[model samples]
Target: MDISKYIDYTLLSPTTTERNIIDLCHEAKKNKFYAVCVSSSYVALAKQLLEQTSIKVCSVIGFPLGSTATPSKVYEANQAISDGADEIDMVINLGFLKSKNYVSVLKDISDVKFAIGETPLKVIIEVSELNKNEIIKACEISLDAKVDYIKTSSGFSKGGATLTVVKIIKKTVKDSIKICASGGIDDIETVQKYIDIGVSRVCVSSDFNKKKQSI
Candidate 1:
């Protein structure tokens, strides 16, 4: 497989600077990776830097932590889209889900999806914090909300993507939605494994950064 096409060169750290995001976009262009994932604050810069290039600019909303209200997430998504973000990676309210508030979680995703219009939306479910049943429920919610992708983690979580979870997601969604595995993936082998299990995308941060020579 052309592994780079399945990767999103991610840089979501709180300390990530503009220079860093610029470098990340440049690297994505150079490597012909799928896209550059960054914080919402950098969406404008990332868009300008990657303009006219095949590389896409992706921004996050209600990121890392999904405790924010649905309106806030929708507003953030709209702003990012207006700033030229080609796709949105959002976090689901884990607390709401754990509280069995499935309606709120679904509304959170659907509202953002509506606000973005044609732009793709990927919902992050922070797999480490969930059990197998919870993961299944998340997939169900993403499908109901009509999100473009159901992501495994935010990488800030205690763990990252696993093949088993990806497989489960694949089975649960049944091609109704795409799956993105993030968090701890750090190499071509792990990325390939996730792809084999049905992850349409893999979020690569530390591993890609360490290989800056190629960038």
Candidate 2:
């Protein structure tokens, strides 16, 4: 499979500089990765860098850790969309999920989705932090909030995407929402494996960024 179309070339590290984002866009444009996911602060720059191309600018909101207040996340997401982010990948409230506060979790995601309006929203649930039932419940809540995609991790957590978790998300969301398997997605084979099991997008970090140096 042409994994480029299914990959979201990602750079969401704290140490990512402006130059890194610029280079990321270049790689995304050249490789035709599905999109370039960057920190919300650099959405406009990446958007400008990849302008006129089919590549999209995906900005993260309340990223990595989703402990921020809901209003802040809403405002941040709206600002990102206005700043030219074609999509918003906001981290879910893990604390709420961990505490089994399903209602709050759904509300948090729904609020962010409301803020972004028509822009696509991907909720990063960080699967590694949750158990099997928790993961399924998170998926159900995300679907209830009508998220465009359910991402597997933030990559800063314990672990990243695994085939087992991916399958659970696929079966849980089914056709109601899409899945974006991120974190630890290493090579074309791993990317293809996620795609085979119905992942709509895979966020690539090391595999893509390291290869960018080769170019």
Candidate 3:
């Protein structure tokens, strides 16, 4: 399936170091993965390391937790863009969504999308936090935000991406926003499953990093 281009090689830990990012980018360059996802603090470094390659530098805003205020997320997004981030993955306000306060949730994503203007925005809905209904509504809100992708998890939740959640998100977004299945995803089989079901991207982390190169 040429899964390499659909993967976002992620190193989003708080303790992630410059050396780690350098090595991660080097691996990404060699593997030709679609992008290298890192915390916003390292966007400049990643951009520098990947300057001459087609590999993209993706930065996360508000990260594993989406409780940050709208203004804060927007500020981070703007800073990332200024630092040369090619893509922005922002956590959605799960608290607001659970509270049935859809307005704030929509605003949070919309404001960041506006700040990062034209840069692809992948809104993480943290599927593990919501029940079936909330997941569907979150997808609807994301479609309205008009972001480029609707990502399933933050990889820090009790559970990560599930095929069930992916199916729901896929059926809901349906040709509107691209689906990004992350979290527990680990191998070629799961990756292919998500892609077959209409997911547009895969956020590969620990599982991908541990593999002893197949090529």
Task: State each candidate's clash count.
Answer: 0, 0, 0
Q: List the candidate numbers ranked by TM-score, top first.
A: 3, 1, 2
Better of 1 and 2 by lDDT: 1
lDDT string, candidate 3, 1-215, tens digits: 58898999999877888999999999888888999999998999999999889999999999879999889998989999999899999999888999999999999999998888889999999988899999999999998889999988898989989988898888888898998898988777888898888888999974575672752
Q: What ranges in model 2 sit over 4 Å off?
A: 209-215
81-169: candidate 2 lDDT, tens digit per residue: 88999999889889999888888998999998887788999999999899999999998998789889999998899899999999998
Better of 2 and 3 by TM-score: 3
What is every candidate's alpha-carbon RMSD to the true fold?
Answer: 1.6, 1.6, 1.2
Clashing residue pairs in candidate 2 (N, C-alpha, C atoms within 3 angstroms): none
TM-score of structure candidate 3: 0.97
Candidate 2, residue 84: Cα displacement in angstroms equals 0.6
* CA deviation > 4 Å runs, candidate 1: 209-215
Best by TM-score: 3
In candidate 3, which residue ranges exceed 4 Å CA deviation? 212-215
Total backbone clashes of candidate 2, pairs 3 or more residues apart or in separate chains: 0
Give the C-alpha miss distance for residue 190 in model 2, angstroms: 0.8
TM-scores, all candidates, are 0.96, 0.95, 0.97
Model 3 residue pairs with clashes: none
